[model samples]
Target: MNLKTKLFGEVYQFGSVKEVLAKANEEKSGDKLAGIAAENALERIAAKEVLSQLTIADLRNNPVVDYDEDEVTRVIQDAVNEKIYNEVKNWTIADLREYIIGLDTGDLELKRISRGLTSEVIAGVTKLMSTLDLVHTAKKLEITATCNTTIGKKGTLATRLQPNHTTDDIEGIELSLYEGLSYGMGDAVLGLNPVDDSIDSVSRIYTLFDEVKNKWEIPTQTCVLAHVTTVMECIKRGVPVDLVFQSIAGSQKGNEAFGFNDKIIEEAYELALKEGTAFGPNVMYFETGQGSELSSDAHHGADQLVMEARCYGYAKKYNPYLVNTVVGFIGPEYLYNSKQVIRAGLEDHFMGKLTGISMGVDICHTNHMKTDANDLEILATLLGAAEVNYVIGVPGGDDIMLNYQTPSYQDDATLRSLFNRHPIKEFEEWMEKMGLIENGKYTERFGDASIFFGK
Candidate 1:
């Protein structure tokens, strides 16, 4: 079978990719059973392999190649297909890299093609060696969480001002948003995963943020990851909802862990569409992670990474504006340490990006794991380099309610500076106008701290 990926609009025919993942996840799933899944998987893997082949040297060298991205993609595909059919094993990463240098692609398509090509390489290679399969929920991962940037939005390093509001106190919630935003955290959206799921609490949240957004003239979207039922009621009551939020698992039972079913998911997605969005055409924002299936005993014998990628397939049904893969937030049971965290971050990012979801990474860790801020920093910067759409820019990189550390506001600034990235265009302009940022950098590291303290 064939399908066009979301971002690059590349058509892919996978053959080995699905089989490798399935075989890795479930030792019994063979090529015959993989069928269409393998074909889909192969396309993504080939894209990554092809992307890895194109080097800066190749670009800088102006190698004797013409600009034919499609042909370059097809060459990589042909080699991968041959391998998937067990016809050859001659094409290595080195061979593919050298081959890509000969392609004639334009500057615009180079990054897009390169990004699409580079995404799925990690997970495919892991299958040849030791598979990073899921383990039993040996230990409980801290469940303090959390997208609503915009659909079809590009050229911006986006982030959500994610603040966990445990209580229904409007003032407390406002302060969190204000603080995070003051620090340049609210670049694309102000999304909150509320602990209080009460109807009144959820309703108050929509009202509070909407009022705050207007009063403060913050040009961004907002979402509350509440029950679809509550959000639907809020919609019925004429409350604003910029994006629909849900936690989905690859396996059915895993979704049951969060009290979600496909019917409810579809209903919420459809309902949000009626409410309209502040940004692009999409109204859904889904959050996913590895180990949710295994942790909830819903993996259905698929490898965790495969299961994670499968969740993106589910998200695509709604055409989400943002799909965030919280790589390390699930704890160490699935991803042991920083190295595992970094690898998972890359794997999650590539899978999401390859699948064509405007992807982001949390790259965070709870106290339960053997990780620190530095580990998250590495993943964040790497994701930044990968041209991911958004990240979680928390205050001080610490989420008090979730008990985890994400890249802080300053880290976002540092990445933006390093990559020469700007926030969502209108947001960048607003920040510069408001003095929250200066010359595309944050105005205050502590985020207008003196104002919060009345200094």
Candidate 2:
């Protein structure tokens, strides 16, 4: 059996590419123009070879290939460009499935293909859904918490640090307190950053995981365990983990304390594979933003170079299971200008070359009351346009405390309406419109009963 048959079973094949193209052409046109256009598209699809043998040098050199970036920009621009002469066609679900199959079968060389193809695919899917009016109603959102022990301060609720709360305290509060807040409102994935404090970090993380797993019953797959400390702990514990470069800034100062060097990253992957755990780098968070004191533009450019180099190097060394990046606040400096935050995020994505990064582009500090609905909508749109895999945020950060004294938005339809109007609603709507339904449809499919009682 072929790869697709093996994965999708015998019922998977819908139609041949040629037949589907012919039908599409016939549905749209009585003139030869449609037929000619369909033929050209078919030819383009066939002419592009799917698979190619790659050398370490090819992977290393691709990031710096220095093609007119304008050319790349133009390709993507043309995909979205609306001029009559510059129109780009959209692909159907069938077409997308076939393309994914081609990639899976090693018929397409993923790395060599223009990143523009990814953009085109996303745009095509978005347009197709709009044209069909088949968009879903439920919205999906990802909320991540970043805890930095070194800073001596926990993050706010959404991006808040995991308190140095003891294992017991974490267990007592995490499931009943935070889980409801996260689940009652939106789709959430907690990101634990265990920086330097190994014993305490691992113990607390394991405890939190246990509470989430046993008490709340969160699936292991849904929870992302990101380790910013040593890789050996990850290996010893046999946990699928994301490796973050927390010590990069310190490394620049000739301090090895928290830095994740190339060797360590490589070792993490090798060990992960041996232990049957997925491993990927979280470089975008450490290298970009104010942490390095680089200007937003400069920081983005330099960070991309560094991420590409490291990602390419690692991919060359030992094909990673996945590639991931974090798009959150580097420090308090970003609070000064929200535009800078948006710019920094876009730049962070460009630096990563937008491939193999599973779950890229998370909002670092999005809880402040000053973060308007327009800004949130913009952030959602930007993340969607960039083809970012996921985004994380809290419904009420420091701004909207959800303690017993403070009323939760759950009961307030007015507050929920406020959320539904601007960025919150826009983000959810955009995801649904684009057919990214994983996060949003959780409640609809599972029902509220699962939250209170697992049945």
Q: Tell me the TM-score of model 2.
A: 0.44
lDDT of 1 by residue, 1-455 (tens): 12123335655432333332443332212222323223344454544443333332222122111224222222223322222323213334344333333334332432333333321232333333221221101001111111233322434677788877556467878888877777767765688888888777887888888897888777788888886677778887788777777777765567778786767877877777666445446777788887777777665444576567657645655667778888877777776678778767766765565444567778788888878888888777776666667788777778877778888877887887787777777777777776767665556533684453546
Write down the TM-score of every candidate: 0.70, 0.44
Compared with the true structure, what per-residue lDDT tens digits does model 2 show for residues 1-455? 11111211322221332222222221111112223223443332321211011221222223321224322222223332243212212333345334433443231233333233333232122222221121110011111222111110111111112222223345543543353333333222243433334544555555455455445433221222334444457446654333323323211221122344445655654554455322222212232232332322222222222322233222322332223333334333333335544544554443233232233444444444234445545654554443443344333322222210112223222232333321223323433433333554433422132334333
- Cα RMSD of predicted structure 2: 17.6
| Runs with alpha carbons beyond 4 Å of true place in candidate 1 | 1-155, 276-279, 441-446, 449-455
Question: In model 2, which runs have C-alpha deviations exceeding 4 angstroms?
Answer: 1-111, 114-168, 176-189, 194-196, 214-218, 222-231, 237-257, 276-328, 332-336, 350-353, 366-373, 398-450, 453-455
